[model samples]
Target: MSDADLPFTAALYASTRTEELAPLPWPEEAKRMFLAQQHAAQHAHYQQHYRGMEAWIVEHGGAAIGRLYLHDMPGEIRIVDISLIPEARGQGIGAALLHDLFAQARLRERRVTIHVEKNNPARTLYARLGFTILDDDRGAYDLWEWRAAA
Candidate 1:
């Protein structure tokens, strides 16, 4: 396959132990821990529902550095989860990945939405991209969404 296809060739697997996710092709530095946790803790959701959820891989220099897990419904696309290793942050990987995903949503005419931990720095990134605050849970996260131009 061509290089462009290579990046899209990233693979995803479910976690059997509900623990750390299987490693991606990127370096450990690129996948830094978040919130004082291993930061690789979401693999369980992917593994358990592998058949139902769709995984999109994000790559840089032909190496997989992150992932975007989505839940697509009739009229909306929920960005159920996204992550970039610490090493990959500040290098524009997140923005690029998000842009591609949202663009896909726009093309399908689906409203795009996601949940973010209040303290995550990516919150600013989403805001800059025009996603607005919709609702929130007092505990830790807020719901955000972006709609197509009317």
Candidate 2:
């Protein structure tokens, strides 16, 4: 993602967390402010930990729709994060993207991994795509991995 995509990327981040934030009783402006701060922090953390990671802007109909962050390591391709705007979700865009990533991973014989919230709905899709829980700390997130069969 480029500097031009920052606003849309922030909005996509907020959309992903909207359901969790809905019951917080914060005013809309306050929520937006918090989301912006959180997005900045997360972005910084990812950049610090996964320097040179690949970032992609998911587009549909010539408009930006989402963001995909990836880190390709020697043995695994880590999905740092993926978020879509509310209007663009549940339309198979995410699945298609994952399938494409899986194809690439298969070609390189590398495992694909992601850390997802325990209750995130996308976990179901990852399961359907053959990802298995590689580590679960019983915390907010679990590490999942997928490998193409021999």
Q: Among these predicted structures, which one has the highest TM-score?
A: 2
Estimate, for each residue in 1-150, the C-alpha lDDT of model 1 and write its tens digit: 233532222222221112343345545544433311332344544456544677666667977666677888788888877766556767887788778877898899998888887877778999998899889864688999988778
| After superposition, candidate 1 runs with Cα above 4 Å error | 1-41, 46-51
Question: Worst lDDT window (10 residues) for model 2?
Answer: 1-10
Error of 1 at 38 (Å): 7.3
Q: Per-residue lDDT tens digits of candidate 2, residues 1-150?
A: 887888888888888889899999899999999999998998889989999999999999999988999998999999999888888888999999999999999899899999999879988889998999999985899999999999
Candidate 1: the clashing residue pairs are 14-47, 30-85, 31-85, 32-86
Scored against the true structure, residue 61 in model 1 reaches a CA lDDT of 91
